[model samples]
Target: MAYCKYHPLTASTYHCESCQINQCDHCVDDDPEHPEPRCFVCAGAVDSLGATDIAPFWRRLDRAFHYPMNKQTMMLIFIASLLASLGAFIGGITGFCLSLIVTAITTKYSFLCLQRTTDGGVTAPDMNEAFSGGFKIILHIIFILIGISLMIVGVERLFGGLASVLFSIFWMVCLPAVFINYARFEQIGPAINPIEIGRLVFTLGGAYLLLLLFIAIMIASVGTLHQILEEQVYFFSAILQSIVSYYYLIVIFHLMGYLIFQKQKILGFTSRLESSEHSAGRSSQNRMLANIDVLTKEGQFDGACATFKQGLQAFPTSYELHSRFFDFLYGLNKLDEIDAFWPTYLDLVGRQGRENQASTAYQRLLLLDKHYQPTSPDVRYRIAQACFEAGKSVLVVKLLNGLHRDDPQYKALIPAYELMAKALDDLPNKREQAEKLRRMMRQLAHHST
Candidate 1:
């Protein structure tokens, strides 16, 4: 009874790998009778041949570490433990020194990955970029260590008890700051702030001070009471101890609850904002659609066309609605409708607007009647201009010929005729044709005079 390799839903089997239970034809690597079926999941052969296997040490190491699998997290924990042990064996001074460098490098690379992942997906940073960031963090740690050493030496040598007390305070503050700095650069955790460190110090210090004050008051009160009522004083002291213990526990639980609840609230708010943005986008699309219908009903064809266009931009696939609306506007012979819709219509057909639309409209006008023609000299000249712009010298020659024959009185075209003559001359394999065009232009020039 062979088990299915892909899905557990079906219970069927076949003699060949290609028709194996739960496996598609595409999933088969090779013919079963040729050698053996290779299990892609485990990289093992069902039918064995005495073939030597060669694989990279890194690949093996990767498999062992479970590179992309759930085991990768376990591998990271293992590495951290091993590194920490190595650090401890080297002594606190050496361990801290080396671990700082290692931590900085690892953290920096991880941070770059995190940043890229945040932007989109888990993009692998180039080795060079990773190394550069890692080195920068290493340099930062060196500077920090140098500064700390100088501070320590200066306080020890010059300042006395007061300096020692200040140094103690500084050490407590600096330890957390250093941890945060390393974490940020290495990308281990949240960014560090000197202000945050100061706040933590002040908060915890105040709490400790308050606790000591309360303890002192309790002791003093008990001592005073003991002389007057020794037996009653012991019971009062026991009660005071119990009350203090309970108060501390309540404060701890309250702090824990606040941290957990606030985190959940922040996550919920972020989700709601994302959903709201999607809803707003949908609402804007609906509003544009409504505006289109209103404008068309009012017989504001031009305004309606423009509004419909704006709606299309908001929702591109609203072409079915736009097409029906456009046909209604076209029936009115609205020239502005032609101007407004022609560009987008040409774009949808994947044709260049200025050249393709003009050429197309010109051809349609010529087809209406053999003698029917464009009234605008500027439109004719622009057609010739487009030909030249497209590097179609032959087309330019043809357009200029038509324009000259149609409107000889338009003196604005002579300069264009001359320019076309020059471009025809520069065209490959058409020097003789270009000379004929120039001669024809000269004859036209003579006839005009």
Candidate 2:
């Protein structure tokens, strides 16, 4: 599976064939006029991604190894392949079944990871996900293979025929496209249907041909290495050959899938590829925020809010809309408004690791201004933690005191004493007081048990 070249944790939402890199939704630029999004590095449409716009393919060939699939996961897969190979040597029903099942499981699992990566998630799938699409993934491949087998059987022996050669060439060229469709939709109908398959190939045009050429070379190279290893006649060499072969098979599969993701706009699959929210252009966002600021200074809070809401309606994923509105509300002491839109406040700085700012927002909601109050234990604990981190031990104590008064056995208050002790311990004359609070924390812990 291909992950975002920028953030390894996040899966890729789109492939910028222009910059020759994968990007998550946060990094992609969608201008609404195009179905496929261009990355921030590419200034124009996805179609404008020409050879001059990207790095050489040879330099970027190492990106398949740059996936989020960690060494431990790949190591586990290698070990599984080793076991399956050993089992196949037994030559019975058990061995045959194990070999087929292991191959199916590994391929399905790899495809699941690819799908998840393109969907903009971060984590590589665990082993159980290999069984998720289950027999369906294997079945699609089997169906296509069966069809090819039938075609070759019917035509290969016919009178030194041109038809046999033509069919063989057709199957070879269309095989990658067939698997690409199957991987995306999980249906044999989509894979084997000639019209559907042909449309995808033509829509993708030279790109599909280039991808096929690349896959052919990639597999031939890996397979040639495996052939040399097998000729070495060593057990360890054979095991390593299996590992290399299957590993590159999955890599080629991902390359094919990324081709689809990059060309999804023309293929009408952009809805699946695009993120849930479409972000507006930066200039459009700047203009919207500027107008909102004008309305706010003119004492039209409702108009400012309405304009902000409309802009967000148009561009739900606009970070500036969220953060600028948060700052505007904060500047006006609009505590109720800020509290109402707390999620936007959190999302504004989500990618920036702004825990201190989040704590500050919680402080404003819980303590800074007394107008708006949240009355949940979870809320209060969050407020106390944020206040503690903000270095407001007094407010932390006040919030904890309220919780303790309401429920004398409130175990969460123990952390309040812990925070208080840490803050006091840093001061010159407060060591004894800090120790006293530590004792109180211990007493609470002991009594709670």
Candidate 3:
């Protein structure tokens, strides 16, 4: 037994002959018969993409944040994954092929997602564009897996039981290695080469362990959820379980790509665009926006306005900055200014598709000042519902009453009545108000019909 190369304290089960690196059971490809593990250089042709150095996991974690939470990107991942699941359900080679195609699609978009965000842009990747390279991707995966399988089986036969267990651990950690290689090169040869795989792992060092650990935990969590659902055996539980598991898979895959992005230099990958910090600093619009933020937070309204105007000068098309400026003006009761820009502000907010935020803002506007009128009927409808859920009964009633006063034929009165009924039933204090509301609701229902 030897100490593992990565975890020095741990006992090593196998040694990689090519790289002369020692690894424990957790690091080698599991083949029960293999006499010894081979390093990535021999396993796959090493890319020598980056140095063996990687930034601290905690440090890289922050810079890696932008790519993870793009709802649009997430939706794409989910849809691709869902399609893959549907394919698998078809239960044949056809199904397998379809699933593989979707896998390639998601992988392509996943990498494109990283490039777009890490290189200083924040746009959602187009779904069609992301799904562009399906057939080539499937071929790459097929070649890699088939080639790697031979190496793995031969090694297992040479070493037998103990080496088999160790190989299993190696296989576990190699998944990301395989993905990163193919995603970067889009080729079967490098991705499947054991040497390249080993080199990538060796370069990742301890962060690789952390990545492995996170993946294990994520899989275990999803499995545990599936088990719990299985125990209940509900009619829809299987569907729910499948959805949760596939979603987790997409997240883990995204995480794998992000790891590569975080350690790009060591992995030999390069961004085609400028670094984020340099780009942000060079942008006059960004500087002015930052200045406006600081000035506004300090209550320097005049200074904030000056900074806001400065940002607008350079970024005339930036609806994001324009929206923020409108927020500032709205806060300061500069209605004249807000009204002047209402068309633009509304257009931007509408185009941005944050109707929920707009609705909430509308709610707050009406709740704070009774004189304000909502631009849409749905505003009062949603706001009152939100207020009820938050236990703002007074506000709910007030909003409902005002809407009713404004229009006796208000559209959402039924939902409002149902909510009030529930409130009256649940709260003893509100029960007294319930009867009157019920009577009015009945009267309104009768008259409307």
Candidate 4:
């Protein structure tokens, strides 16, 4: 007799080598044919073999590096990352400087790629050619530095200090212009413009200079005012810090605005170019455009609804699509659907506006069919109707009057007017107002007829 490791079910004994549990057959469920019975500990160890039997490390790395879902873009990112990491490993300070430069370059490249992708253009850049070009740039810089050093030491000594200074200033200006031209060449092609390259350089340089100037001013102000306002300096410092913070915030907002607006313009031009190419194959383009029209057409409301939903999935920031979808759903009498879409709709519209599409949709839903019943108007109007039905005539009349004043064409208010008349028909305090409403209803009916 051998004891079961897990439980004492019955005191019957069997030697189970698979689980290494000495137990009766009732206590151990062991496979008989290959029953060199693995113990519970051995079974647990066997389960861990699945995790260890994974693909080789290099194979996993290759998949991660080369076979990204966005293959072309990811390859560019991989190259950039490899370069950045290599640069960083050289030294901490060198790494930091290189990281900044690489980050800036990669960010610009990514923006260009995104712009091209959105415009339906091929955004693939030749990585080998790009690396070769970068090497050439490094070689050029080395040559320029060597030449400048030789000229400064040899020619400047012969010419004089004043002559050397003039020459240095001239070279400083010319160097920037030359580098700008080279950068333009690097970026410009059939898909990209030289002006765009120039603009990017100008924007980055200008932003950097502005940020430096702002920091200088903030430092100067704080240092200059510190001793003069010694007692109240802390309070003044707090105020100054807040102003500096807000100024930076404003600068950030300005940069974001410029980037968004500029990118839109650039992408628009690229889209136009793609569209021109598309137009060259007029019949095919027309067919494609016709298909798009069919999908988004007003007559095919269901398809339009689906297309709008798909567009929302793709471009969630597009308020225009949400507005169009809301209209489509409203037309289909999907009043309940309004709640699901309104939050997104209002966020898109923002705080200040006259023609708030979401609010209008909500108001329209409330005025549906003019009846104020379950299948008639929406919940808000139905609540008003319920008050009238429950003999809360004063509340009903007040709500209806407010609605009539705010939106005279609210269809539910017509029924509200009639209900108000009935609710106040014989009431001692409201007979005169009720009579006037009945007269007005009569006139409305006459005019409508």
Candidate 5:
């Protein structure tokens, strides 16, 4: 949740270890040609800050449960479960192979869920994507499972039952990491590598422990439910178990995905959420603003001015663009240019009902050139009205003092006189003048009638 160094309002998702500064996604160089993100400041590879913007898996259990409740996911689960149930009903070596195929297919979908979720795509993927390439992950998972079983059996034979029990428990705890690693690299070697699994688990730390706790609870719950169904209704219990297993598979994979999302920076994966946020920050106005900042810093004032002018043209109503340009002009001491820009900026802010901005801009222009005044009668009146409301009685009187001489045909003359009269009434010795102004207002109203 660290804010970007350049734009304080935006959150940073990448950091430069060399510069020790956090950057928003859009502020860094994300060239597709270079897989790693490069820093805009030093062109060095940046570290991901990870999915700090998203909630942790433990905290989002409701979402995890509902993730597979979508129509497509439900349909997939039902169909897969029915196939597996049919395989069980067939009851032979052929039936066993059929069931294995169904298991592999479902496991593939579950792996797909984990992969997509890790990439910040929380929604269940289309059925087609799930079926397309999940068979490979199933093979990797089988290898991992077989490897764990053999290692446990070897430990029991060499070091006795206690050692085997400990090894079994260790592998049980490392199961999630094993699957996560496989999903990340999509390779059997890395998925089964002890170092890779340990690194991921260590990085996840307490959150991983929490994940294990949830997994244990889910497993126990599912087992108890299966037992209850088996005892009460022997006929449909297998089908029910298949349905429940598929549902929980989606949920667990989704939870794993969220875990990766929350730590994607450490995991070195860009998430859908991060990509989308970066894209959003690259709007034309923002790009222009960034360019202007760069041009100004490089001492290219003319080019910066040109870019700033183009930004104003492209996004005339952008308050940030106008404000930044005004500050830039003020910094350069370009009083003449600022004077030229002030009226348009003031009118724009006023039309947007920004009374404070209009008032502040006028006051700043006045300080730069005491004789400065907005030529438009409406702009002058609006500023005066704002001043009066802000209790700047003297400034209001100065602003409206000779309205008739300046613009005798100004439309809002009655309101101007009324505001002037109110300001005068607030002064100590101007009570008589205020009374005279009120009489003038009444005379003007009567004449208009």
Candidate 6:
């Protein structure tokens, strides 16, 4: 349970042997270009010292039971349950497809809950995050479940029902470990490896048994709810049952994820949260960028600008470096330098589809020169679209005005025309202009064909 050298309240995730200092995830150098996390000061390889201060999963049963009680998590449960209910009520090919979607979504979200919980995300994750990695996890879980089930069935056939029952019990005990491994590594082989499961089960000792007890209770509670609602309307009953099952499903996964988090040190596992934070640190170009940030903060604009000049040369295409440099120059009121840099900065942000940043940068440029226009038609098209989406219709029209004469070679003419038409329609007393743009769109379509 070593505390961070800089932030005493926070648990240290890495230790710099070179600096002989304990650094939290935030303080460690997270530059992705580097092979490993480096010390902020020394730029030397640091060893991962996993968090040891977390309470065991059993000790936090109250919080574990309420983990899925958040608005986001409950909403997921309701949506999945609603789909499951419809599938059960319809009971056909369409129903089967609906049911399959529910299963996939539920399984994906449950694993995400586990992973996020392991990463120190106390609250339930949003829907966007659950589907971020796609349905790959669904396949992995299916494989693990099928492989384990087959092993149990094979034991019954080769030995006896009693022997099979014993093996089932043994597997039931190791189930949490199996899932933790699966969530941790996201590979079926490590998850199903008997040796790995056995090692994990042994390492956790009595706490593993406590986790098993909670898991059994959570599983049985779902069945108990079904029985209690046996006399209710079938459709409504199905929905309730599904919701309860998903609620406990998330809780179970959260518990397993927390178990890993609590015992990360002994398990030699770095939770995803720590790893991601560690990686999000300054990059290989961090030293210069960091020095620039420090210098800018200290009101050493001259030195910061010097470093920015050097950094921009070294990492010419780096959006982050360019962004920070742009901000610094703007703060110093270096209008000429900003004018020279604006097009490149806008293009960098536009190419990345960073709509918000591009729009903000465009506004910043607008301040410098009221008639500011990017030299590149592509950059204009992107920023105009971004402004239009942000309800800056005037900006959109201004950006796209006279584009045909200026950059007729622009490949995105059709979309640009369509966007201009829409923006025109949105503006007051511009219907005639909008219709004219619409006619141009028709003419363009006719020509392209």
lDDT of every model, 2 decimals: 0.46, 0.64, 0.61, 0.46, 0.80, 0.80
**What tens-digit string does per-residue lDDT give for candidate 5 at 225-279?**
8878877554367778888889988898888888988887676665655345454
Best by TM-score: 5
Q: Which segments of model 3 are wrong by more than 4 Å?
A: 1-71, 77-101, 111-124, 156-168, 231-239, 265-449
TM-scores for all predictions: 0.26, 0.50, 0.44, 0.25, 0.69, 0.54
lDDT of model 6 at position 14: 83
- Pitting candidate 3 against candidate 6, the one with the higher TM-score is 6
Model 1 lDDT per residue over 1-449, tens place: 23334433432121233323333212223333335444332334433211112122223333322322334333333444455446655767888976665455454544443333222222233433444466676666566666666666677788876886787677554453344334324532222344544543454444334433434454565566545554655544443433333223222222222222222222221111111122224344454444444345446566766766667676665545445554655556454554455445534433424454445553443444444333455544665566566665655565566566677678776777776776678678768877887787788788878
TM-score between candidate 4 and the true structure: 0.25
In candidate 3, how many Å is residue 407 off? 73
lDDT of 3 by residue, 320-384 (tens): 78878877877887755654554554555556654344445545565546666544445555555
Question: Can you rank all candidates by TM-score, best first?
Answer: 5, 6, 2, 3, 1, 4
Per-residue error for 192 in candidate 3, Å, reads 2.6
Shift in Å, residue 277, candidate 1: 10
Runs off by more than 4 Å, candidate 4: 1-140, 147-170, 179-300, 307-327, 331-449
Candidate 4: C-alpha RMSD to true structure equals 27.7
How do the residues 1-449 of candidate 2 rate in per-residue lDDT, one tens digit apiece? Answer: 45766567866666756667765555555656657555455444443221111222333357655543576558757876686777667659888887777777777876775566444323455766676565677876887889777767677777446887887787789888887777678777887776788787888788778877877786788778876776675657757777766676666665665565555545554434222444543466665565565456547788888888888778777766876777777777777676667655455455555646766665555455663454444455655566677777665555555455566655567775676567576556878988877777777788888
lDDT of 5 at 278: 58
- Give lDDT: candidate 5, residue 246: 91
Query: Which ranges in model 2 have alpha carbons more than 4 Å from their true place?
Result: 1-61, 117-123, 152-160, 231-233, 271-449
